[model samples]
Target: MSHLHRAIAFTATLLAAGLLQAGQVRVAVAANMAIPMQRIAVEFERATGHELIPALGSTGRFYSQLRGGAPFEVLLAADDEIPARLEREGLAVPGSRFTYAVGRLVLWSLDPHGVDPQGNVLKQLPRGRLAIADPRLSPYGAAAIKTLGGLGVLAAWQPAFLQGESVSQAFQFVASGNASYGFLALSQVMRDGRIPRGSGWIVPSQYHPPLNQDVVLLNGGRSSAAALAFLDYLKSEPARATLRGFGYEVVKH
Candidate 1:
């Protein structure tokens, strides 16, 4: 081959390699989404040759970070309202928001067959501690509070409660037997619909407002091709199936 032609071919190959290497996305996610998001991140990296750096925390805390100029490309929040607010404030890309999952609350206990899903399980507890995330700072905690109120068990069960900073922490509290029963996400309790090492009651969706999980591409992430690709992957059929497998409800809208 001619020297010029060889040089041109080598340059083309380098460009292709660079394109293929464009696979790193940074994401800020709500702590409740940790497990499912980790699973999805692996699948995404396999399918698209991308790496995901996920920062998990309370939705409120993440919002504070984003507002304070944290270097995140995307935000996976517990509620759509926060993403909408970010968009309105020019922190997120306009029209780049979508609901990813409808979260479910569960009343979980460490002992097998410990919880009674029927009604007023709190009244039957044998002096064991109950754990709940703090309602003022965590969305899942707020939902739990609302569910308790709706079930007419709030006032009766107040003294038995132990508070966690976040839903995942609350789950940990129950899992470690620090609390006998705790409010947790259904995804946290169910391993293919059956509970893992503990008994849990899948709270009916009607009892509380829908736990809509939303994702948005931040304005800073717009220039990140990998970030955009990861956002698209979250809505893909395989991703949706994985989320459903983990007991999260996939929203069509």
Candidate 2:
């Protein structure tokens, strides 16, 4: 064989090896996590040469979709429960779930003075629509309900509530003036480690159950190297830093 032919065959073998090592990971992400996850996704791809395909929405909705056989390879949920449930249902890889971030709830308004630091605005809440996620679907929405109930305002506020299917949608309600105030994930309204240009009350953690966001590798990803690599990347320093920047609490391993 000619020397050029041997060189070409070696180059083709190397290219095939590179293709075999890279893959795509399909992930279902909670709505509140959309922004930060986008930042992490860019980093992950650059570092690992893998593509991350993310579908963002409420964790509860994702659970329903998963049960109906959605082709997602990983789930980044707003709460730990649904992921655990998926494990019990044999849909997720056992022993592959972990808490990625603990989220904080916030009562936000576009008006700079709309919400008070102590969240006292709820006491004599202005006569306008109050937005919250539907407690049936979002953990943040459930936290909002618990906060209102703890503050003795749930019953009175129900009359003026505007419910969204996910926390992101709830934030949109306030941002678009469809509602004057809304319950949202701190991450949704935060920028550069703080709430910029808006008024918000960071709901005291004691007001509701801890928002332990969990991520799990699903059965669909059991054989995907990219899926596993993404999970490991999520726990790395760069990813955790992004989570913290968005107002999430990351537990050190």
Per-residue CA lDDT of model 2 for 119-236, tens digit only, reads: 9999995678999998999999999999999999998899999999998899889999999999999999888799987799999999999999999989998767788777777878
Candidate 2 wrongly placed segments (more than 4 Å): 1-20
lDDT score of residue 221 within candidate 1: 79
Q: Which candidate ranks first by lDDT, i.e. highest?
A: 2
TM-score of 2: 0.91
What candidate 1 gets wrong by more than 4 Å, as runs, is: 1-20
TM-score (C-alpha, index-matched) for candidate 1:
0.89
Against the hidden true structure, what lDDT does model 2 obtain?
A: 0.89
Cα RMSD to the true fold for all candidates: 7.3, 7.8
Whole-model lDDT values for every prediction: 0.81, 0.89
Query: Which ten-residue region of model 1 has the weakest summed lDDT?
Result: 3-12
